[model samples]
Target: MAAVTEPLLRTERMALRQVTRSDVDRLVLLNNDDGVMRYLDWRPPTREQVVAEVEILLKAYEVYPRHGQLIAELADSTFVGWFSLAVGADGPAAPELGYRLRTAHWGAGLATEGSQAMINYAFAELEAERVVAETMFVNAGSRRVMEKCGMRHIETFHVEFDNPLPGTELGEVRYQITREEWLVARTSR
Candidate 1:
């Protein structure tokens, strides 16, 4: 039998574990929700798209250990959603935080809870210089979560999507928290 590895991160209400092939079905449902996808892909990702993405994420785990998407779940194993501290071309020194929760779990502070945990991991464990997150300018809820996690608005930039979603005209916003800022906030809390 395979040994059960510990979760990558944990919070008061959830555990974040590495994403697995088995998570595809749950992820498909998450990627399909209208409200959840509203500010994201803007179109539901088909199963094939989700599957291929999962395969890539799985491969990334082998190469980049703890820097990728993770499955967030309750203690009882109920799926909430996913959170990520993903590396871009700039690599692991700076990671972008991202998340999506089930609409059923909306308004419960789960997004904020999970985000705070990810930021902590980025600064404390990863020794990252900075952490960042981005969302559509009109995504008030996401922006609020970033604020609550001690990130500050850093930029507003436009991207020309081939087919833009409504409110794309307002552009997108980026939020960031530096290691110094995170340390100060950590001490104050």
Candidate 2:
């Protein structure tokens, strides 16, 4: 068996690691949770969809060793959800940050903690030019987490979805922090 590697990122309450084949069921649960998927796909992903997504995420590691969706777990290995620092449409130099915690773990600051760690990794370890994130304008909680991570509001745009979620009319928001901004914030703290 291949030796398991250390986690990609660790925060006060989470250890973010590469998503393995074993994690698909839990990921399905997370994706299927109505509350958790509210601002996302708007419907639970089928098991096959989850499996395909995991395969794609796993392959991403080969192309970009520092980027891929990761599973988040507690010290005892309890599933919290997942996080990602992916090569965005802007390219590798500006990766996107994303996270999803089980509803049971919400409001405990885990999202903020995990997100801050991903931003730190993007700027400090990967030498990324910028880190970006987006969510529905109505997702105040996610917006606050991005703000706390030092990402400023950069854009508010809309995408026409055939079956849009309830707050889709309000548009979506983008938040970002440049490496320079991250460095300044790091020094100030």
Best by lDDT: 1
User: What is the TM-score of each predicted model, taking all chains together?
Assistant: 0.95, 0.95
lDDT of 1 by residue, 98-170 (tens): 9999999999999999999999999889989999999999999999999999999999999999889999999
Runs of candidate 2 exceeding 4 Å displacement: 1-5
Clashes of each: 0, 0
List, residue by residue over 35-153, the lDDT tens digit for candidate 2.
Answer: 99888876888999989998998888999988988888898888899899989689889999999989999989999889989988888889899999999999999999999989999
Model 1 global lDDT (CA atoms, 0 to 1): 0.91
Instruction: Mark the regions of model 1 whose C-alpha exceeds 4 Å error after superposition.
Output: 1-5
Instruction: Kindly report which residue pairs in candidate 1 clash with one another.
Output: none
